[model samples]
Target: MVVDEQFRLHPESTAYLDAVRGMGRSVNTERNYAYGLALYLTWCDERAFSWSDPGFENLLRLRNWLVSTPLPVRGRRVQPVIRYRKDG
Candidate 1:
């Protein structure tokens, strides 16, 4: 069920999800893949890179960005939350 900001199905990602489901991958695993793909796609869009063929160097840059950037908070915070913690 991966889609873009336009709410259209990303055909390739949807196909990939279908394949993994056929192979008996768990729902949680599929969910993780979907979100990761979405994140990568969004990064590509923001940086004006072609998601289908971002160069290796750009991908390496993305790896660096992943560690350097603080992830967005998941929901409205009722209390103080630590920044950049992988888990809390």
Candidate 2:
């Protein structure tokens, strides 16, 4: 079981990660998706939530969180810039 700085450990997670890599997933892709899943699980634990919850909202929230993480490219963290004007 590999525990990163985030302190998440699951041997099953390791097997899943290895399976993806064995199937020719890029190292970065495996790393990112695995880390994201671990983070999501941790979030669920903190909130006392379960994957069995019959709701799509939680899944949507996870997708949103993934998009919100800055993507590293060309030695930089880049994200699509969005701006909204406050109307009073």
**Strongest candidate by TM-score:** 1
Candidate 1 residue-wise lDDT, 1-88, digit = tens = 5455678888888899889899999999999898888888889989998999999999888888887778667778886464662431
Please give the lDDT score for candidate 2.
0.66
Best by lDDT: 1
**Could you tell me the TM-score of candidate 2?**
0.51
For model 2, residues 13-87, the per-residue Cα lDDT tens digits are 778888998999898999887876777667666667774472688777766655675443433337545533232
TM-score of each predicted structure versus truth: 0.77, 0.51
- The lDDT of model 1 is 0.82
TM-score of 1: 0.77
lDDT at position 8, candidate 1:
88
Question: Over 4 Å off in model 2, which ranges?
Answer: 1-8, 51-57, 60-88
